[model samples]
Target: MVKWSISILLIMLLNLAVTSLGNVPNFDYHAFYFIHQWLPSYCNQKGTKCCYPPTGRPAADFTIYGLWPYNDGGNSLQNCPGSSYDVAPLKAIQNMLQKDWPSLTCPQIGRKFWLHEWNKHGTCSKSVLDELAYFHAASNMKNKLNIFEALSKARIIPNNQFYQVENIKAAITQATGYRPFIFCNHDAEGNSQIWQVIFCVDKSGTKLVNCSGSPQGQCAYSTVKFPSY
Candidate 1:
C-alpha cells in the first residue's frame, strides 16, 4: 500500500510540472535580444543631453521612453517628466485585451482604461499601458475610428499625427502575439525615471525590468532580470 501511495504521489507531481510547462509560451527571444543590442549603442551615439531626465538617456534600454519621447515629461503631454506615453506599448496592451476578450467594444475598452489608469494605478505603469493598448487593438476589433473618436473616447493618441492608444495597440498586436509586462525600477541612486517591458519573471513570480534615468547621469540603466522561481 505504501509503495502504491508513493507512486501515485510521483504521478501527480509529474502532471503538475507538465501543466506549468504548458503555460509557458513559445517566445521569440531573439527579437527582444536584437532590440537590446540596439539600445545601448543608440544611447551612446544619439542620446541628447537636452532630453528629459535632463542628464542623458541610455544607449540601449527596453522602455519606450528610452527610445522616444513617450513618457519623458519635457514634451507637451505634461503627464510626467519623461512621460511622453508611446503609442506602441498602448497598442500591445490593447492586443492582449482582444486576445483575452474577442468581442470587446469601445465602452468595454474604456472600462479597462479606467480600471488600469485609476483603480490599478501602480500595477499599470506607463509601459504596461502601452502594452495593454497595443494588445487590445491588435487582437481583434475590425472597425476603425476617425481622429476625434480615437483620441477623445479611446485616449490612444495625444495629437492627430501620432498613433494614440487605439492605433498603438493595433500595431503592436499585429507585430507580436504576446504582450510584454511593464514596471518601474529604482536603485540606490536617486535618478529614478525610466520604463520598459518585463522580460522575465522575478523570484517572487513577478515579471521584472529596469526603468531608471534621472536629470543627473547618476541614475541609469541597471541589469534588471526576472527573479528565479
Candidate 2:
C-alpha cells in the first residue's frame, strides 16, 4: 500500500510539472517590429559615457534598434528555442551594416550587438530564420522606407527643435502607408526627446503594415524634441 501511494504521488507531481511547462509562454512569433533608434538620444539616455566608433560617428538618421518578433496580438517574444546567432550568414550585407547599422557605441562591439540582437530578438522571428535573412530583411526595409527623406520632405530636421507628434506621424504615414509607433525619453532637462521609431511589417517581411497590437510608449508632451547627433 505504501508503494502504491508513492507511485501515485510521483505521477501527480509529474503531471503537475508537465502542466506547468505547458503553461509557459510560447516562442513562436507572428509578426515583426522594425525598431529604429536615434543615436544621440540612445547615448544620452544610457547615463553612462558612450564610446564612439573608431570608424566615425554614426549617421544622424535612424539606426536599427532591433528587429523584434511579436505575436498576432503584438506581444513580443525573445530567445526562442532552437535559435542560434551566426554572423557567417551576414557576410553578404556586412558593408551595408557598416554604412547604415553601425553600432553607435564602440563600433568594434558591433558584432556583440548583432549577436545580442539575434539571441534576444531575431531568434524569435519565423519569417527571418537565419542571421542573413534577418539582417537582409531589416536593411531592405530601412532602405525602402527612407524615413529621413520623408521627414526632410516635411522639413522636420533633427536640430534639437520640437515638432508636433501628429505631423511626425503624418509624414511617416505618408511615406510608408502605415503609421509608426514613436518612442521617446527625457533629456537632462526633462524635455521629452525622440528616441526610436518602430514599424510593424508582415510575416513575409515584404510590406509595411499597421501593428495589430497597439504601439507602446507615449510622449509626455504633444511636441517632442529630436536632439542632433
**Residue pair clashes in candidate 2:** none
Please report the candidate that would top TM-score against the real structure.
Answer: 2
Write the residue-wise lDDT of candidate 1 on 1-229 in tens digits: 9999999999999999999999954321111100111122122222222222222332221222111111232111112222333344445354333323222222334334333332222122333334343233322221221222322344432221222222433433344433333332332332222223222211121222232222222213332222111
lDDT, model 1, position 74: 17
Off by over 4 Å in 2: 1-14, 106-108, 126-128
Of candidate 2, the 10-residue stretch with the lowest lDDT total is: 46-55
Error of 1 at 161 (Å): 10
How well does each candidate superpose onto the true structure, as a TM-score? Answer: 0.19, 0.88
Tens-place lDDT digits, model 2, residues 116-165: 88888887774456768788888888888888889989999889999998
Q: Best-fitting candidate, measured by lDDT?
A: 2
RMSD in order of candidates: 19.9, 2.4
